[model samples]
Target: MNTEVPRLSVVVPVFNEQDVLPLFVERIRPVLDELGLTYEVVAVDDGSRDATPVVLGLLRRRWPQLRVVRLRRNSGHQSALAAGLRRARGQYLVSIDVDLQDPPEVIGDMLRLAQREGLDVVHGVRADRSSDSVFKRWTASLYYRLIQRMAGAAIPRHAGDFRLLSRTAVDALVALPEHLPVYRLLVPWLGLPSGEITYTRAPRAAGRSKYPVAKMIRLALDSIVGFSAAPLRVATWLGLIGIGICAVLAGAGVTAHLSGTTVPGWTSLLVALLFLGALQLLCLGLLGEYVARIFTSLQGRPAYVVAFDSATDAEPAEDALCRL
Candidate 1:
């Protein structure tokens, strides 16, 4: 095991990315090597069912800087990233996806900016995303805008997880008590000295996108619920609106009865009942989401479990720091 801490750590959270692993390495290695910095690439395998683990094992033999951490089960991307961040032994840390859509070459720029400007965080913002599907681009735009409004943070508009963090920023993130953290929001909320570099996002080198519509929606929910109480406030507003409607209906009912023109229509009553019921249910559902997260946090369950860590000499102990 290498006891020496590297100057930089590149943490890549991957799941079933067998086809793109080689290409990712091919592109990223040269950038790191050219920068002439001591670095380690920590690739967290989020319980891949394909050849990802095998490929990583083979790559480790060739690239000594490559360290593989396999989760015991299929943890989500953020969980896998958290595991890597905890295990990283570097002065500077970076989180990027294995898809290669965010250019690997830009890593050098991030490092340089972090050093030259003395910034704690350097964000790799996307200048152009012309390669993405129409739906993806649209939803991503809406997601970023919505999160900024709800979270009350000026998170970079087009920045994903591709960014550099200084040692102080890394330690601060690791110490956060959040069970389900949205790094995009959490990092900006840190109020660290930050800078941004724009890059044109390229198409994936190979394989399909791991983040489908369902996962995207899940991530958005986590971000919204984890950082802000705007959902609860929205629910309050909805309840008020529902009450106003009911009051108006009651006034109409009383006026019609007093005027002696009471047309007994089941259809109007049924529509009003259904609409109010649906609105009530929607508000309850939103509240339920926050309550469920609180319940999970109170249970004290680990966010992720590591099945194996290639960087360690012995098996991870029961109380390992990476347990969460």
Candidate 2:
């Protein structure tokens, strides 16, 4: 860890959030001021196509402590987060969404717990998340529990990216080299001195959520395969079960032929074949998913490509991105 200490560094991953920035800054500034601590807001511009950068430029001009990270293109949320963590200088780091759904004031509670309890990471768990749709709530519940059961890692339930980590925790996280990082899983695996604070997750101040069903499925698969080998094990188990079924059916067919009862119902045989074939394919597909992740990792591709950065406080680096 560096000898110089920063009181707090808030890393907000920005997407198409132009409408919310003005209100977000207004709400966050007073809370930080009340804490009476030196802080910096790392607003990560994750290749937003909206006026997000313009708003960030305005904010940076107004508040010198504001630091902006511009990704070369639209990296997913986790990659954008990884980019911000790479550049954070604070002794304690806080990760949040720019939507302002998680109140800025929650940081006060997290910081308080960190100081008083001497914890390495403080998680902000929502006491009530009913603001989300019923389907979303159900899926989220299932996803967290399934990850915990299958992954063998004790990821906190109801904990999103809204959390605070001490310098030690931050260092441990940054040392990890997995090209694809699922932050929720990685934090628990680090095994830090963790604590949780309860809060009400507010509805978004503007715009719909960035995470739709398809994105949620992608994230779930990444978390499961990235952290646990259970999926691969399941693939093995499924193949073994299929073999057992096939052997039993073959024996039955031989017995029928010997007894001279003669096999009847070609439809039944066809049904059995289809069912077994489907199972075989499903198991193979699961194996393929794990193999695909390994192949992607072996390629040594960065999780995110930073086309340009202005974190050093220079003029906007002209778009280095090329069109196809």
Candidate 3:
């Protein structure tokens, strides 16, 4: 085992990525090897039910620098990334997905930029995502715009979780109290000295995409609700709007009564009731989401539980490295 700290750590979160893991290894190993820097690839296995673990074992036999951190269950992608971040023993840590969409070749550029400019964080921005569906492109743009405005940070557009962070930056992120961190926002929110490298996104080299529409929406919600109180404020504004609407309706009804134009009809009453009901329900739902987050924080449950770490001999204790 390489006991010495590595110069760089490449943290890749894996979840049922059996098909793409080999290809990812093929591409990423060469890029890092050519850099001639002592680096470790910390692959966080997020409880893959497939042959991913077996494949990882096979690859690790060939790649001495490859380290595997297997979680007890299928923790989400972000949690797996967090586990990697905490376990990574490198001067600088770079987090990327196992999917080949985000090119591994750009890691060299990011590392060089960070080293050259003394940047604590280097973001690998997607210069072009023409490979994505039109709906995805449009929604991604909208999500970024909305998040940037709400976060009030100059978050680089098209920048996802693909980024490199210096040791200090990684420490700062790990020290955060957030249990479920939306790193896409939290990283930029740190306001660290940063640089950007643009890369054209390629289609997935293998395996079906893990992020479906539902997960994407959940991520947006987590990002928005985690960073800003904008959603709560939205609920408040909606309540005010509902009040104003009720007042206007009341006035109209009073005027009709005074002018003797008031007709006995259930349609208007039913419509008004339905609208108010929907508005109230929406507000309640939003408030419930916030309350649920509070409950989760109070519970203090770890985001992930490490099952095994190849670097360590014994089976890891529950929540040993995942208590954030």
- TM-scores, in order shown? 0.96, 0.93, 0.96
Model 1 global lDDT (CA atoms, 0 to 1): 0.92
Q: Write the per-residue lDDT of candidate 3 for residues 213-298, one digit (tens) a residue.
A: 99999999899888889888998999999899999999999999999999999999999999999999998998898899999999
lDDT of 2 by residue, 1-324 (tens): 133456999999999998999899999989988988888888888999987877787777777777878887898999999988888889899999988889999999899999999999998888899898999899999999999899878788999999999989988888998788999889988888899998999999988789989999999998988888898788788878878988898898899899999757899689888988898788888888888988998999887776545556446633211110
Global Cα RMSD, each model: 4.2, 3.7, 4.2
- State the displacement of the C-alpha of residue 195, model 1, in Å, after optimal TM-score superposition: 0.3
For residue 164, model 1's alpha carbon misses the true position, in angstroms, by: 0.4
- The local lDDT score (0 to 100) that residue 138 gets in candidate 2 is 96
> What C-alpha lDDT does candidate 2 achieve relative to the native structure?
0.86
Clash count (model 2, backbone only): 1
Instruction: Rate residue 153 of model 1 by lDDT.
Output: 98
Residue-level lDDT tens digits of model 1 in 1-324 = 789989999999999999999999999998899989899999999999998887887777789999989998898999999999999999999899999999988888888999999999999999999999899899999999999989889899989999999999999999999899889899999999999999999999999999989999999999998899999999999999989999999999999999999997999899999999999899999999999998999999999999888888463443243333
Number of colliding residue pairs in model 1: 0
Error of 1 at 279 (Å): 1.1
